[model samples]
Target: MIFRTPPRAAILAIAFLLGAGFFATGAAPPSASAGARLALGGVALAFSVVALRCARMRIVASDACLKLYGPLFNQAIRWADIRTNVAAESGVDARTFGVRTPVIVLTSDRKVKAQPVSSYSFSGGTDTPADRIAGQLEALRQSS
Candidate 1:
């Protein structure tokens, strides 16, 4: 799974337009649907760009080792090197962890594997890619 965070410009534009849409939609006099559609389109475009540019994290298992590669970091772990498999949620990190937008934690040898990647703040909060990565890693662990 590739976890990607939208670029600043994209995020800003989306936030602005979406906020505008919400305000416009909720005003004393509702704005036209056309304006809302345009705002939504801009948000979609931002997502598309992030999806295209962000590197995906993947697990390729072999008899010798498990290889993980993605935007932030890469490593190959022989079966013996794996201490344990776990499932965990990304903690309350607001883009400071260098984790992809939506922070998910992956554990290895009593430590959490992390990567430094770009992220942006949304109207709700900052988006982190960790949850997606953690989910993929959990699936890989279960399959193995």
Candidate 2:
């Protein structure tokens, strides 16, 4: 089964607005320097890509393994390799915006990986709650 986070409209909107702003300002004669325009365009493009990747973040579970997909990272853990799955609030303030966000922590033999699965509110596009995902992970570990 595959579970995915919800589409974050705010992030998408911000990306779009940033791109539009760059284009709008780039059109002005005083700000039309090629180097500056290119720099702004590159930043906007990066933001758009980041937002798109974040919106598409998901977790895929199969009989043999679990896969975590994120904007900046990806990991796969075999069922046998999992020591435990824990659900807790992440301390990262940037992602939380002052509110605590739920995170799924996967403990394996070699390392611990933390993945943010839900936002503080419904706006975060968490299709499945972190605790529920932890439950599913636990079940998968048991079955394997």
Candidate 3:
């Protein structure tokens, strides 16, 4: 089973636009130094790479293991390694974003196992998506 966050394409588009804005900044300023332009372009390129990598974040669960793929790192764990409810950090997230960010705290050895990564603002407020993901993961874990 694969669970993905909503607005996956929107996140990718925003990131791409932001990176383009950075590059455009270097073009507009009349006194932009070569060094400044180079620096901005470098940052823009790095953001683009990261955006491409992290935007389509998803959790893949197979019969043997669950894999989390994203920007920071990727991890795969056998379903047997999961020992608790696959759930969202709703309360903790609400403190910062006034919404339950769609981050499933897939736990294994007390570390994150998978999530469809997105900012709270973009991921939406309704806990439905997060809850749905958690429920699906729970189902997968039990079946495994």
Candidate 4:
């Protein structure tokens, strides 16, 4: 099964707002500060495109392995390498949004390596539940 990231409309909305601010006043030639604002707006717009693309990241699970696709990182774990899969909350409140979301932690035999799967939603907020994905991963590990 393939699980994809949720739609990030806020990112795109911010980008649009920033872009609109650049031309809201008038179409006159841009001054130095105006040019800077334009550049910043362009950067935000570009970032939105990248974010939208990355938001399509997929977690692919097959009989042999599970793959996690992210914007900057990708991880693949074979069924044999997986020690256990559990759903847990993230520590440290990484997003600064005051919401500490749940994540699926994948433990391997290696002591130093633990993969956290944050793509799955467990709060009955998203269509796919973390328990279902964890269950599938556990089954795969057991069968292997």
Q: lDDT tens string, model 4, 1-144?
A: 775424332343455455555444343355657676676666666655545545455578887787776554677877666667654333333444222222434463452112223433334343334445555656666777
lDDT value, candidate 3, whole model: 0.63
- Residue 23 miss distance in model 4 (angstroms): 12
- Tell me the TM-score of model 3: 0.71
Looking at candidate 3, the ten consecutive residues that score lowest on lDDT are 98-107
For model 2, the stretches where C-alpha displacement exceeds 4 angstroms are 7-29, 90-111, 114-116, 121-128
| Best candidate, TM-score | 3
Task: Give lDDT: candidate 2, residue 116.
Answer: 32
Q: How many residue pairs in model 3 have overlapping backbones?
A: 0
Weakest 10 consecutive residues of candidate 1 by summed lDDT? 116-125
lDDT of each: 0.45, 0.59, 0.63, 0.50
Measure candidate 3: CA RMSD. Answer: 3.9
TM-score for each predicted model, relative to the true structure: 0.34, 0.67, 0.71, 0.53
Estimate, for each residue in 86-137, the C-alpha lDDT of model 3 and write its tens digit: 4555544435553333333434447563445433433445555666676777
Compared with the true structure, model 2 gives a TM-score of 0.67
Looking at model 2, the pairs that clash are 6-125
Ranking by lDDT: 3, 2, 4, 1
Instruction: Point out where model 3 deviates above 4 Å.
Output: 24-28, 91-109, 117-126
Q: On a 0 to 100 scale, what is the lDDT of residue 81 in model 3?
A: 68
